[model samples]
Target chain A: MRNIFIIFKRELKSYFNNPLAYVLIIIFSLLSMGLTFVIGDFLKMNDASLTSFFFFHPWIYMIFGPAIGMRLWSEEHRMGTTELLLTMPISAWQAIVGKFLAACVVLAAALLSTISIVFTVYYLGKPDGQMIVSGYIGSFLVGASSIAITCAISAFTRNQISCLLVAVAVCFVLVLAGFPRVTEFLRPNFPALADIGNSVSFWWHQSEMARGIIRLQSPVYLLSLIGFSLYLTGVIIRGKRS
Target chain B: MIDIANLTKHFGPKVAVDNLSLSVQKGQVLGFLGPNGAGKSTAMRMITGYLPPTSGSIVIGGIDMLEDPNAAKALIGYLPESAPLYQDMTVEGFLSFAAELRGLDGQRRRDAVGNALATCFLEGVRRQSIDTLSKGYRHRTCLAQAIIHDPEVLILDEPTDGLDPNQKDVVRNLIRHMGKTKAIIFSTHILEEVEACCTRAVIIDRGKVVADGTPDHLKRHAARAGSVTVRFQNAPGGLRQDLEKLKYGARLEAVETAGSTLSAVVYPKTKADASNLSAEIYELARSRNLALSELHEEPGRLDEMFRELTSQNKV
Candidate 1:
């Protein structure tokens, strides 16, 4: 546990030390803010709820999550630092969790910085505080799972561009699985596949939490996604230990 | 202390290290000598518990690396061939991170980082980010990170590879200082490094150890254990044949002429009996009433021995 914190602190410091962290945050903020105001007509809605802001998180993270996770292991392998890291006393699991949680902290900070949107909604009208909090929680989980998937793919290849492309493609599929058009299209020809897609979709579970439902299974489903992705990442990293 | 036995590593159908075995005791600086692709780095990785061997055992400080990697690794400080480093980190920060990863905390971590900085002469650039430093400084930073914990066993692969002459000397001195109390195994293709600091040396070729001994012992493996060179005032005809027939306690392996000078190299039947060949040659020249211009014996050459032992085309 202590070793994990040591790695986590180093990784977190590295993110802030590099220009990538600020660049990622700026891109995420611009895209999310732009999607909410321009596309969702957030200001014209006149409603206090941040539905537009919360709705764009999956798409925003699809770009920024891979941006953050692409360098997690790919850069290590490329720079030969993997040899230094694996030879240390810490286990592979500690290194994985440390890097993962450090990335989560960065995502959390970016997400929390959008509290200005909450303030705007509050000043305009009375918003359901419960739904807004639940929406933030859902967005956080979705962002974490996206980062996990990106990290898993990053571990398999030393090229950061390849990692980003493959992660974006897979996340696109996972995101589309929950869309109404994809589900409706699959329902007529592939009923079982459609059911599986809907059940495993990121948006399907996130929507329940965004609506303030807070079902036990929704968080469980997201947690399982995180666990499964991280497990696969661990396996891939262990496969090339030292 | 480190003990490795029958270590073998295979990348699919290709073998990297083949049935390699060696032991490094405390206070021993074993120089691992090999050309590129000779499995020097692979063997070091296995000894440090980073790579699992295909079939072998590594015992570090009495802890088997395969069975208990963490404990074994805790005792080892490794500097890989590339001097792996995070370029974004400052020297102090990176060394501190390494110290923390080695389980040091608070004041202990501070002291370890400080000691490493002082030892590696990195105090001036401790606050400088690694990427901005010169290549020599980056190499020193990597060395500092490796010794931050002061482990009992040190496995360094090509530690002084990219450094200038001064930096190389500093690193060599540091290795010699550390070798007093720790078991250190460093690999380098540079022959001078083995002669300069290594108490014992192992020359590996094609994943197997071809020779292992002290510097002098390995030097004697040269084709000519020792030689006597004499420049005669008068260039005698058939001088080469006469020198070869002198019956010096050892066989005259080669007699050559260079600019009216004659030099004959003698090889003892065994390395132990190479004592009086030069003296015998001098007495023979005196008895023949041949006034000598120059009479000197050349000890074995390490580079020649290395080339001969590790030559790739040897049968």
Candidate 2:
């Protein structure tokens, strides 16, 4: 556990020390704020919920999350540091968890910067702040899910492009799986498949949270997703070290 | 403190290490010598618990590597061949992270990092980002990270590979100093380094050990039947007979015509006997009215031992 924290601290510090992180966070904040105020209002239907702000997160994280995760294990493997890490006193699991947590912390910081949208909506209209809070909760769950999957995908290849492409493709399917159109098409043709898809989709579970309903099932879904991704990452890291 | 038995690693159809087994005593500086692609790195990785062996067992400091890798790894400090490091981290930060990973904390971690830096001569670069440092400094950083926890066994794969002459000397001296107390295993192709630093070595080629001994022990094993070259101006036949008759408790094989000179292998049963036999041959050549133009000993070097070991085992 201490080893994991050590790795986590190092990985998190890498973000601040490396210059590329400044550009990424700046771009991330501008996009989240701009899309929430400028673009969400353009597409608003006068709803008193923070549905606009939460909706843009999945799309935003699809790009940013993968970019943040692409370097986690891929760079270690590329630089041959995987041996150094594996041979250290720490186990493979500790390092993976540490790195995952580091990426999560950095992603959380980036996510927190978008709170300006919350304040903007709070003052601009009589929005249900509870629903907005839940909606942010849902946004966080989705980000966690995507980042977990991205970290797993990043381990499959050393090239950042392949890591990003795989992460985006996997997250894209999960993001769209619960959409009404996707469920409608599969409902009659393959009802069981649709049922399975709806259960796994990010939005299907996220919708309840967006409306200020914190279903026990929502956290479970996100936790399970993150856990499974972390397990897969463990396997990849073990395979790589061998 | 280290025991390995039948260690093997396979990558698909190719075998990286083939039933390799060896042991190292406490405070023994064991040099791992091999040609490229000869399983030296693979063996080191398996012992360090970085890579699992396809078959066989590694027991380091009384802990089984496969059974409990964490405890086994806890006993080892490994410096990989390329010395992988985080470019964004400073020397202090990198070593602190390594020390913490090894289960140190607070003042202990700080002191361990400081001591490691001193061992690797990295005090000046403590605050410098590893990327901004020279290759030698980066290499020392790698070495320091490995030993930060002060493990009983230290495995280094080409620890001094990229350093210049002076930096090499520093690392060599450090290893020599460290080896006085801990078990050390290091790999390098530089035979002179092995000769200068190691107590014993295992020369491997094509995934098998061909020679294992001290430097002089290996040199003696690889020496061809000690040869004595006799360049004569006249009477080659008489010289040959005279040389053949003067064998006193030594086995001499005479080559009749070796490049316009009669070259013969004076196979003294022992290398210690070869020196005395050379003078005996010189007198014989002189007594026969033959000008002993050239009478010299064969080239026996540590490198020759390495080549002979590797070349013969090449698959």
Candidate 3:
């Protein structure tokens, strides 16, 4: 536990030291808010809830999560610091968990930066505070899940650009799995395929939480996705030494 | 404090490190020497627990590395080849991070970082990011990270690889000083470093141990180790024939003749004859009324010994 915290502190400090993190946060904030206002038609919806605001989160997180997580293990391997860090007195699992949490915190910060939208909803009318909190929670989980997948992919390669490309490709498929058009097409010809798509889709679970319906299955699915990806990261790192 | 036995690593069909075994006790510095692709770095990685061996065991400070790596690793300070470090961190920040990872904290962590900075002469760049430092400074910063916890065992791979001459001298002196209390194993391609800091030297070839002994003992294996060189002025005509016919002299070659001055070298018949060959030549020069300018037995050269041991054509 102590070793994990030490690694986490160093990783977080490194993120802040680089200008990439600030740029990512600013871009994520502008894109999410801009999409919410322009495309979602925030004022014309005539609803006090932040349904329009939470709608664009999965698409925005698909790009920004990999942007932040691409450097986690890829930089370590590129700079040859994997040997230095692995030879230290900490276990590989500790290092993986530490870096994963640090990147998740960066994602969390990007998610939190859109809290002003919640205030805008409250000022216009009496918005459901519990629903707004649930929406933020659900959005943060989607971002965390995206970062975790990217972190796992980053462990497989030393090139950050390759890591980002592969991760975005994977996340794009996940986002498309349960899109309305795809699901509508699959539901008629292949009902079973549509069910599997919804089961693994990031949009499916996130939209459930956005509606303030905290079903046990949605949080459980997202948490397990995060857990499985991190476990895969540990496996890849251990495989490198052998 | 480090004992490795039957260590081997095979990458696909090619064997990297093969059945290598060596040990280092407290107060002993073992110099690891090998030609390129001889598996020196691979063996060090196995010992440091960065890479697991295919079939072997590494015991550091009496702790088995494979079974309990964290405990074993805690006692070791390793500097990998080329001195890899976090380039984005300040020197002090990196050292402190290393100290913290080693379980030091608060005042102890501060003291460890300070001592490492002073020891490696990194005080000038304490606040500077590692990317801005020169190669020599970057190398020393990694070295400082290795020694931050003052570990009981130190494994350094080519610690002075890219340093300038003065920096190399300082690093060599530091290694010599630190070897007194810690078990140290460092790999280097430079032959002089064996004599400078190592108490024992091991040379490997094709992933196998070829020579293991004191530097002087290994040097004695050189082809020309026991030969005697003699210089004379106004020497007699049959000097080469006379020197060749001596009882202990195996062969004699006249090296140079400029004007009335001549220099010749006599090879000994056996290792035991080297000590007496020089005296025999001096006595011969005295009796023949020859002016003997210089006569001395040649010590073996480490570079020659290294080349001979690691040469690919050796049977």
Total clashing pairs for each candidate: 0, 0, 0
- Show model 2 residue runs off by greater than 4 Å: A42-45, B228-241, B248-265, B269-299, B313-315
TM-score of each predicted structure versus truth: 0.95, 0.90, 0.98
| lDDT digits (tens) for residues B1-315 of candidate 1 | 899999999988888999999999999999999878889999999998788899999999999998889999999999988898998898999998999889898999999999999999999999998999998998889999889999999999999899999999999999999999999999988889889999999999889999999988898778765665566665578766676665554466456667766656666546655556666667867888776787666667778888888785855
Clashing pairs for predicted structure model 2, backbone only: none
lDDT of 1 by residue, A98-154 (tens): 999999999988886777788888899999999999998999998899899998999
Best by TM-score: 3
Q: How do the candidates rank by lDDT, highest first?
A: 3, 1, 2
Question: For each candidate, what is chain B's TM-score?
Answer: 0.91, 0.84, 0.96
TM-score of 1: 0.95
Report, in order, each candidate's fnat.
0.85, 0.83, 0.92
Worst lDDT run of 10 residues, candidate 3 chain B, spans B235-244
lDDT tens digits by residue: candidate 3, B1-315 = 999999999998999999999999999999999998899999999999999999988999999999999999999999999799898999999999999999998999999999999999999999999999999999999999999999999999999999999999999999999999999999999999999899999999989999999998888889989999999898767776787899899987767878888898889999679989988888898888899999989789999999888886855
Q: B12 in model 1: Cα distance from truth in Å?
A: 0.8
How would you class the docking of model 2? medium
What DockQ does each candidate score versus the true complex, computed on alpha carbons? 0.74, 0.76, 0.90
For model 2, how does the per-residue alpha-carbon lDDT over A3-122 read when each residue is reduced to its tens digit? 888888899899778776677778888987778669788236566567766767777777877888888888887888888888877777888899988888777788787777677666
Poorly placed runs, candidate 3 (over 4 Å)? B258-260
B134, model 1: CA deviation in Å?
1.1
- Cα interface RMSD of each candidate: 1.5, 1.2, 0.6
